[model samples]
Target: MEPSDLAGMALIAAAGPEEALAFIRAGVSSSPVLEVEMTSLLSEAGTARWPGLADALGRWRPRLPSLAPERDMGVMERLGGGLLIPEDPQWPPALDDLQLNAPIALWMRGQLPRIPEQRRCIALVGSRDSTSYGANVTGELASSLVQRGFTVVSGGAYGIDANAHRGALAAAAGGGASPSTLAVMAGGLDRFYPPGNEGLLRAIAEQGALVAEVPPGTNPTRYRFLQRNRLIAALCEVTVVVEARWRSGALNTAHHAEGLSRSVGAVPGSVYSANSAGCHRLLREGAAVCVTDAAEIAELAGSAGNNLAQEPDAATALHDGLGVEDLLLLDALPLRSATSAEKLSVVAGLGMATVLAGLGRLELMGLARRATNGWQRGAV
Candidate 1:
């Protein structure tokens, strides 16, 4: 509720981000100064002291009733979130690279983890009408990246974005020190957009973070959606488009990422799928490298060394490699004592034929062996 924040909200509501930055550049002094002296400043507009300020200030004057500080504060209080400024520790320094386009203040809900110096954040974006292939790939990549301790950042939309967030949530529940995912919203935090995604957005707010550049009460517009893409790009070290139609909004995010010099990646899709046209275009233009999984994306996000391979742990590796039935049969046949096939079947909840087949596979793989007692798990 500070004067500066109020001033920023007013300017943003009035002249939009680009014009607000113009006002700031033209020696507006401070937000409070602008708020109080706006009339005088406008009266003297087109003069040397306030050149190029008239148009924006003129636009701001009429919108004062709805854009005032008191109204914004009420929405903030109702939403139960706080405002983040440049001085605040949680304010992403990456955004400052946007220079004047950087938000003056961010309306935020939920918590953000301590972003590491190397920027272990990756963005997962794609078409709103994504295919199952894209959703499957996005979920796999997002969860895997979380397992590798990278945070996933995405716009809180349907299709690929929802899958990415869901994957991160699943990974976090498995228990680890990985940071939570983030969703950048185009509209005010007070009104979650895409009404269908209310449950998912609420869950994300509970488990991760929800961020918006505009103040409360602002509904999303096409212009705002395109503008918000910049925030999504600036928040992470890498931005990936999993699926995009030609001229999709995700392409906008990729452009922002490229402008920031952040790594850009695209998930390849079927040649005929329209959903992948944008990604294919990016790949063809050399705007993005073809990325398929977490390891490749991890390298782009600055994870160096030959460390992408899982660490050597024979027992764990063997366990991980087993099929469900094979694993169950292996567990049924204890390491020290072999058990009968019928007993193993009952314990593994598999049919007798399935148990026999699984036992044969395990025996062939050296994970189980036939003994006088019937079958026993392989020795470590």
Candidate 2:
């Protein structure tokens, strides 16, 4: 295919599989002009007719998008990160099942860790203004979940979201290939929502996946944030809420996950904290499973093998193959966990470009994973 054709495909892919298919079918059936436009492009580009047709007009159109070049790059720069089109081998197929809500393009800055095939992924969500008890409980649950090989997914907001990511990272540090954590953002990946989480968001993206449905530069509106929650509910096998007010957005996410037939889990909190009201309501309504830690979450979601344990040997081989800067960066990583590029710059005393370049190399070697917060040594 010509570059433009590929670009168009990428743009569509960024829009999510369902929407792309819907647009293509709608164009083909309702607008002869669109079909003609596509045909002309295909002919000029000398692309394979069947694959293009299948991608554009297939039954899955509602789940994908065209991902045109202009749109893709614009989204990327806006997110202050790069784009990962389906063509990128790292693209996760699990997202393809999201239908129209599936993200067409993923706005990301840090590294996307490899998710073990067929592992259970669960989302932990709660109120932005959570109580200390709620936050602490969320963190502990998150930490335990990661220890058992379940990838923890959260919104990356303050309170519960931040706690969950921290818990997962801490658990990952404990030496098993536990489930990595993921954060789905409502705003562009370039900007962290609370601003306080600028560091935390970076770490999640690097070590796991920081995903968004909107194009980069799109500041999340109330409606958009609500819409984004649906994507989170759909991506995971289950959704867990640590705390929420009566009208909390986390409840909306829980509802969406329920509608999708995904399991819903909640952590029962003290009756006094208004933040815990939502969780209590969910439990009363029979909308969620009461969970305490990673093991409980695992029992509800199942578990994966210790894939992370196998990471070190592979990382060793990969590390031995790195260039100088990469070696420097790897050396700079704290033996215990991850650190951000800015911090690494300070620790390694390297320039930003040098750090980034070295990070790219270390990422390739699988010697490190980038978290939404920063960079961390990879689980071997």
Candidate 3:
């Protein structure tokens, strides 16, 4: 096992899933390498990313020989839950898009299939203080999607998320009784957040799933809530924003979805409603396609012949593995004259850190290189 994998395993063994994920989310996690002993899987990305993780791991090592997987598995069995590490057959393939940013382990309750039916899942997201218009649209959309053999995925928060789950539960799954909806929680699945939605969440757990990256007993925190949005995006083939304010966290989920190359759709609400501003913004920015009804939303789920990504031409192949932002940054690099990161940032209209990160990726791909002066183009 890599030092990173050993580090994660040690953390899970010492802290349990909740603390382990907390340790990772502190910004310490790196792209994972697979070798599992996942009571805790520490990041190879190192302690600089996680901060105090190195010291904690040092303190936890003495107990490693005493670790008992069977005991932990028994505890999980009693809770009707289990841990999902990378090597597990049940791990969702869709999460692979997250690359180094993927969760170290998934703490799950209810049934998680051996392989996710991601094509049949669509995430419904919006503001917590959603309006009647948003709720009505989410409800009808969720109901219609469920009827069409699609599972509704959401954050399990109040407003739009709750309505999405309720609508799916209320719809008849003509195929038979099975999961028609699922909630990706920000906190531990052991406790449902917002308390007002407890009853509704319980129903979701009974019929579908309540999944989290953090282990049980972890409270729902604002940052955790924001971080969990990526999970919602990764779990589905399509993400639909029902309504959102200009600064709503739902926009984070939409961004993650787009990064994963999943389809994103935004509902159009009244232009006057501040809640709709985010959707309008996404439409204006071309981040999401405008979707009005269930059928339109379903079309975004996928097409029979169009599921595969279009093959890039040879000219575009040099840009392969580069993200949208990286491509933009690449355009700013000089061919013969190296320029500083500051110059690259202004030229690319990107932040310094983004410029540096993109440069690192480009360097690895042989599309960029560093010189005494700064950085310049490298052979593709």
Candidate 4:
């Protein structure tokens, strides 16, 4: 079929199933361009032959809208690379299973990543204000999945989502051949939401894939974000929640995934943390698999033996001879930066003299550095 015809069909599909069937029936009857065999098949699938059926279908007419090719093209251009219509070979069939809520068109900005040949993609989602435990678990699971040649998918949000992407990138950097990650956005690709993740999102677009259902110039709303979560759940083989509060939007994504017959997993978190309440609820209600690592997540998705087991000696060799005080000081350092002696003393719950002695030993051993204002942990 011609691109214009495909665009028209997509517009009707976006409108909803009933209108799409109507358009298909009308197009088949009037236009020689539409194949009779194809029309008959479509009619058998959902289109109505009798007036009763037609009346039932007519109730959905309001959902259909006129096609705007120029507007669509403009939106595509604003996104940098352009759009991917259903007619495009790169469109994944998984999304077609969404029935009515599936996107009419996709606004994309990068080369579409090749879907893994054997492994199913899984989405990891959670609260934007995730805790250190949540972020660490998200990263480990995402990295494990990537190492096993599974694509990790998530919204390009902060906290858990960002950590998931970073883990995937780390796996890719470690010589994995797969696409590793994908970021689905609520808004248009003209800009990244949260702004802080602009670099990370760009890296994803380059190494993996970044997708959106909305047109450019469209800002994300609370309603749109809820709808976007559905897409993330549907597109993946499974959805995992790393962390979520009682009011988290991540639970909505999990619900949508479960409704669609997709596997759902949740990482168990601290009982005292409000951020873990949603996950705890899911576990209690039998809505999710309790996942502790990427291996467990992959197993739940029916992709077993994909995780790379860690080499045991790697950890032992690094910390085998460390003194108690030195280990305490090391544990006090944040993953991203260093701490001052005073801050380290507070964190390690040690005296200033003890922290200073430990810092001196650590600096001499090439394990830490004294910066202009503070001490930073050095690469081991």
TM-score of each: 0.67, 0.59, 0.64, 0.63
Candidate closer to the true structure by TM-score (higher is better), 2 or 4: 4
Error of 1 at 260 (Å): 0.6
lDDT of each: 0.79, 0.71, 0.79, 0.75
lDDT of model number 1: 0.79
lDDT of 2 at 9: 50
RMSD of each: 14.1, 23.8, 20.7, 15.5
- Model 2 per-residue lDDT tens digits across residues 186-230: 776656777898888777766776777665556777877787787
Q: Sort the predicted structures by lDDT, highest score first.
A: 3, 1, 4, 2
What is the alpha-carbon lDDT of model 4 when measured against the actual structure?
0.75
Clashing pairs in 1: none
Candidates 3 and 4, the one with greater lDDT: 3
Off by over 4 Å in 3: 1-75, 111-115, 173-179, 304-380
Q: Count the backbone clashes (under 3 Å) in each candidate.
A: 0, 52, 13, 0
For residues 173-213, what per-residue lDDT tens digits would candidate 3 score against the true structure? Answer: 54443557888888877677879999988888777778888
- The local lDDT score (0 to 100) that residue 289 gets in candidate 3 is 93
